[model samples]
Target: MMLAFILLPLGRMFGQQSPAMLATVAAMPDVQGAITLSLEVAMASAVIAAVFGTPLAYLLARSQFRGRALIEAIVDLPLAVPHTVAGIALLFVFGRNGPIGKIAGQLGISFWGTALGILVGMLFVSIPYMVNSAREGFASVDLRLEKAARTLGASPAQVFWQISLPLALRGILSGVVLTYARAIAEFGAVIVLAYYPETAPVKIYELFLSGGLQQSSAAAVLLLSVTLTTFIFFRYLAYGRAARKGRNQ
Candidate 1:
């Protein structure tokens, strides 16, 4: 059933005048703009998620602090939360009329109707994937290896840089891939928060609502192709590296 649903659209996409469809979306400014914005904002948010998420993941995997469970729950909240609700929550904090928004306005850093808004929306929706992937990665690291390095006159920092980080890198890379994909595909939160600078998903909705299936399918197919291609590339890199390591072992 799942394959049927998936393959049917793919068939239609290929069955159509694919070259013309590609050319049509290629010529549309809104389509190109949305694609560019989605890629740029998604990449930026992925970086942010990776940087902040790594330490949090390490802490979660290694520490046993009070409220640790709560922290984890918070990290996973967005997955269950309606992103439209999340968008509303964000608005109350980042909208020009909102409290944080007022303070940010003083600094001339806008969130509403801008890239920052898209970044926040993407980050909120996608961070759990990064953090969880990294946490699993960090957890899977053999502490004995870190201990061995430490006993070999290596400091904690050295052990982490040389042993733990490298060991967990595959998981982190996987998380980054998931983060990037989620961010690019985000719709409701981004639409609510950063409407003018429409991301690809929102643009697809716009085309669909205004011009119907024919107009929208081209853009949607292009975005899907781009997303799927990038996803496959990353997956190949991550798994191919792992396969090589396994063979070496």
Candidate 2:
């Protein structure tokens, strides 16, 4: 926290020019495009991760199947690998020469340096957060409640929707937020796979390389501000809902 505060002022002092920095910001088409694309891809990636990951998380939570530990470890592989290595692995699967990418290309859907690439990068790095959080949430739910519902002749889907999901939604939401946050801040993988679309982190890196410290720091501050604001708002919303449910209970 102290380091963050220290960096903020130093970043501002070095980068915040009188008016030129503001003008540079306004005139930065690349930066603007990057920011827009980042948001779009991050949101899409988060949604996709949640949809696929939720069922997997549910299974992980409810069952003690063979290789359960292996599955869990596999889910966390992204966290263990270097970000750049993850990008390279994704490229092997999603590059133009890659089998999936080749098929996608025939269908006019490309991944490299496109919005799809951004989503893939975000998904690659951030999916573990959502899956793990949701699994934990589901695990916290009372198995007895589900059993009772089953005994009452509630359909599987009905029991899940009426009992399990409601009980685990907070955890799911927390995971979603963390995934989104991770996606938003992803740099190495995104830069390697989707440099053309240019997420905020890439833009900052470019500015530093091409322009200078002052230019890059300004962009960094802007990115930080946006991320911090969005996180705070979403966190408050999630916590408030949890609190309200607690009160009702």
Which predicted model would earn the best lDDT?
1
Backbone-clash count (model 2):
0
Stretches > 4 Å off in candidate 2: 1-20
Tens-digit lDDT track for model 1 on 1-249?
A: 999998997878757746876798779988999998999899899899999999999999988999999999999999999999888889999999989899999999999999999999999999999999999999999988988888889998888788888889889999999999999999989888888789999999999999888778888888888888888998877677877886997
Residue 58 miss distance in model 2 (angstroms):
0.6
How far in Å is the alpha carbon of 200 misplaced in model 2? 1.0
TM-scores, one per candidate:
0.94, 0.92
**Candidate 2: lDDT of 200?**
90
Over 4 Å off, model 1: none
Give each model's whole-structure lDDT.
0.90, 0.86
Please write out the lDDT profile of model 2 over residues 35-88, one tens digit for every residue.
Answer: 777777787877898899999999999999899999999999999999999889
